[model samples]
Each structure stands twice: as structure tokens, then as C-alpha cells.
Target: MTKKIRLADVAAVAGVSTATVSRVLNAKSTVATGTKQLVLQALDELGYERPDALRDRSDDRVGIVAPDLNTPSAPEYIQELVDQLSLRDYAPILLTHSSAGGTEKYLQMLVKQNVSGVIFLSGVANESDYDVRRYLDEDERQIPYVTINGRNPNIGVPDFSSDDVGAVKDSVRHLYHSGHRSIGLITGPERFRPAQDMAMGYRQAMMEMCPDTDQTVLHSHYSVESGGRATDTMLDLGVTGIICGSDLLVLGAIRQIRQRGLRVPEDVSVVGYDDSPLMAFTDPPLTSNRQPVRQISSAAVNTLVDLMKGGNPPRVPFTFRSELITRESSGAAPNQSQF
Candidate 1:
């Protein structure tokens, strides 16, 4: 049998007076956002079903945590995710992980907001050092949540992610078909699961494409500047084709290549992941892998809604394959004399 919860129990857990807990649950305007969040988290943690007043108010709001937008594709995914969330009669409240606090902080804070659910669009859940206890708490408290582009198995929540390994292999194979023997792969720090998968795919693809030629995988933070810095190292290694983990990184790679007096496709070919917006408008259109944003976002929303309805879904990740888009940025490799 479930234990009955009282206002005093909630107040004690939240470190506030019973009147304060009542005020928070009654939707008083005087309560601060952080204070209200604390009360809400406490109520949920105690396994107390919120009073009708609080449940109705919180049901109108849903929390969404956006990932680092340097990837370009993230912004697009966010817009779509927000749109989908709105259809469920929930106003999406956006949150982002900052250098000062980290993803865990924002997630803990979300509990206080009394959000109907929380959607994380690629954050620390992708990292190996993620605090499983934090996520487990959400689940233990019966909070509905979903993670996109990453997941921890112990979190026991549905994860929506793209096919990182297959995407890299396709990019490498495409470059190989363009007659480029000296190819390079650049991704985020090896600690990220996506980066590790990409590195593995690159090695496997390169081995099959050019067994005698040795290729190097450059690791860096997922940003334009980091991609540019990695480009110089790949250039020195005589890479005629480059594969980047993110579309923004590809732009950075092009800038660095031009700085060294090299032309894209003419001197070197490039392929990028996460086919960003208006990439074709650049001086040289970019070749990229198209992530299924609509499919993934729709599925994520559907899964989240199911969880909210108390329906149990499989905890396994739902993987979406990326399609390669070829364009002016990639072409036949330059002659050996050019290298």
C-alpha cells in the first residue's frame, strides 16, 4: 500500500514551512522559481501525488534541455522538438547546460519546476562520466523523461540517437569512391560515445578502402575552432579528403584549408555530418550526412507522451540512419603532384 503524504512531509523535505509548501502548490505568484522547483522536487521524491491544483498547473509546462548548438544540427532538432512538444498541450520551457553548472544541475533544477516531463536533447548522458544516480532518481520518482542522441543503459529511459557508426562508414566509403586514398576523420573527444563509434567506423572503412595507407583520426571538441585546429594536423599528414563529425566543423575545416592556400574539392575534398541548413549556399556546397530529425523528434515526442500516460516502453535506443548528401565540397581527389 502507498503511504499517505502530508503538507508537513513535503515542507520538511523542501526545507520550507507548511504554509510555503501550500503556497507553492496553490500556485501563488509570490514564490520564486527556484523555491517552487525545490518544493516540486521534494513532493515527487517523496512519492506523493501532487494535489490537483499543482498537477494541473505543472501539466501545462514541459522542460526541454538543449544540447551544445555548435553542431548546427542541434538547433534544427531543437526547433522541431519544441514544435512537437507544443502539440501535446504543454508549453516547452527551454534549458541549456552551461560551463558553470553542467547538465546535472539543470536536470535537478527541472524537478523543482514541476514540469510534466523533461526532454534532454543530447547532453552529458552521452558521456561516460554521467551520474547514473541523478537519472535513476528521476525514474524512481516516476518522472517522465527522454534523452536524445545519447543515453545511459542504467537510466532506464528511451533514447533517440542517430547511427553514428554507419554514418562515418558511409562518409569514408564515399570519399574512397572519389579516388581519395589519403583521408582523415575528425570528431569530438574520444570520451564521447558518438566520437568513439565514429573512430571505429573510420578505422574499419579505411582498412577496407586503403589497407596499405595509414589514416589518422583527429579528436577535438565539437566546434568550428577545434575543427580548424585539427585540420592543420590532418593537412600535415597529407589528407586529400576530410570527414568531420559536425557540419560546423566542416565549415571550420574549409576555412583552415583555405588559409593554407588550398581550395575545397580542387585541392581537398570534405564530408560533414549533420547536414546543416543552407550549406549549399556556401562558396562550395558541402557534402554531408542527413540526420532524420523529423523521424527522431516525432518518435521521441511519442515515446515521452507514452511515458506520461503511464505506458511502459522498451528502454533500448531508437536509432535513425543518416543519409549522405553529396555536393560541390567533395569531388575527385587532386593529383599526387598537388599533394
Candidate 2:
């Protein structure tokens, strides 16, 4: 005769209190859906007979929560994430974040649908004021999840991301070496972690590389129009080289320079971040810092698969280095050029 698995056995495997497992078994509405599903998966893995409701509501979907999907980098990472998840025989359902609370709302919706797991690309987890309690709730319920790029230490999950600070510093250093003394930065709002880190790196690099000059940072929207405006502002201030926070910004800055009857690398040079797709095909073939998208994406997928199989990945963020790819957009700083 087969032995029956007890609540303690399920709780042990799921890493939740036995009482919580009991609540899950009893279909209590107070229990978090993801937590309940965790207990159910644990029970099934432990060879325990599952209740009828759980057995009937089993789903094979994976939820991907993204904060925003307007950038080229977003599509690049999403495509790779989708391709990797496909190999595991899991279909991806995109949950585009519509508002600040949308991430939590979508998480709840996905939990109700009983997804296999979740991967967060952009969400509240990256916010500066993030609360770990929300993620702790996910842990209590047994939902496995992974994050790409930004990470919160209290979340205690694997976060695959690139080195934003190093990338910006390297770009600044390169421009400094190319004879640019009056360097400036144009980045998005300060609320974003990437922008904040990049700004910090630029300030540090400027203090170390060109200590005699004052560093300038122009805050702007992450769009073509805004990039152009920000670039014009820096140009008016006599910046010989501009480091842009995004590829779109690079394109816009270039347009602004051309509109002022100045040639790239001759009058004012430009450097961009997030080596977005087709950057090499731009009129000047933009210079940019490459994000380890393929590496980070594959690592995120592998980590999620391990979590689903009851394996634990390191709770720390796995950081990858960003490489500077030089092209036509950046060159030696002109001495008092026609700006």
C-alpha cells in the first residue's frame, strides 16, 4: 500500500508553515494564490494526492511582467526571454505594466491563472522605495520568479543584470582619452536605477579624469525630441563630447548637431548606451556600450527553470560587464569648433 503524505511533508518541501499548507489544502481565501500553488506543487512533487480543484486548475503558462516596452532593448531582451522559455515548453504571457500598481495587479492575475512561474523584466521590484514584503509574500506562497537588470536585496531572488556603472564610466573614460575635456551627460529621469547609476558613474569619472572642469548633467525624457533638446542645451554650454543614456538619445543628439550645421566627430562627438539593434547602420554608425542581453537572458531563463525544479539559485544579483563598441559617432574632441 502506498503511504499518504502528511501536511508536514508538504510544508517541509514547500518551505512554508504546516498551518499555511493546511490553509492551502482547505482552499482558504485568505491564502495568497501563489503561495497556495506552491504548496500544491510541493504536494505533487512529494507524491501526495492533490485535491480536485488544484488538479483541474493546473496551468502551463509563464507570466513576464515588464515595466515598459517602448525601447529597442526591451524587445531584444523579450525576444530572447521568449525564445529561451519556448525551449522549456512553456508559453509566455506578457503583462505590460500600465501603472505603478499594475505590476502587483498583474502578478495577482497571473497567480489566479496558476502560471508555472514568473519573470520580472520591469516592475516595482526595481523601484527605490520597493517593499520586500510583497516578494516575501511570493516566497511564502511558493511562486518561483526571476528578475532581469535591476534587483532588490530583500527580494532574495536571482537577478540577472548588466553593469550600468561600469558601462558609463568606461564611455566617459574613452571620451576623455579621445581628448574631450568638456564632457556632458544626457540621461532620463533620476527615478530609474540605470539612469541613477550611470549618472553616479559619470560624475565619478569626470572628477577623476577631468578634475579641473565642472561636470554637467542634463536631465531629459528618453525620446528623440527630448534628446535633441538636451543635446542643444549641452552644446550651448560648450560641451565637446556628449554621453547619452540611450540609443534613441544618441540618434536625436546627432540630429540636433547636424541641424546646427555641425558634423559628428568633427565638431562634437557622441556616445550612446544600450547598443540597441541596428546602431551600426545609423548615418554615422553610432558608438555604444553593449548590454549582455543574450548572456543575461539565458541566465535568467536557466535560473527560473532551476527554481521550478525545486533547485535554488543564488539569492544575489548576477552581474555581467558591458563592453564599449566604438564606431563613427565618437572621435577626438575638436578645439573650439563651429558649434
Q: Rate the local accuracy (lDDT) of all candidates.
A: 0.82, 0.82
Candidate 2 Cα misplacement greater than 4 A, ranges: 1-59, 98-101, 122-124, 128-140
* lDDT, candidate 1, 1-339, per-residue tens: 646769898999999999998888766758888998899999899998876446643776777777655558778988998899878777887876653167567766766676767777864555522453464343334567788887556566789989999999999999888899999999988877788888998999989889999979999988889989999999988999999998878989999999999999899999998888888787798999999999999999889888877688887888999999999999998878354
Model 2 lDDT tens row, 73-152: 88888898899888878888887766435655676677676776778884346662243345424334466788887676
**lDDT score of model 2?**
0.82
Alpha carbon lDDT at 197, candidate 1: 82
Model 1 is weakest, by summed lDDT over 10 consecutive residues, at: 132-141
Candidate 1: give its CA RMSD in angstroms. Answer: 8.3
- Candidate 1 accuracy as lDDT: 0.82
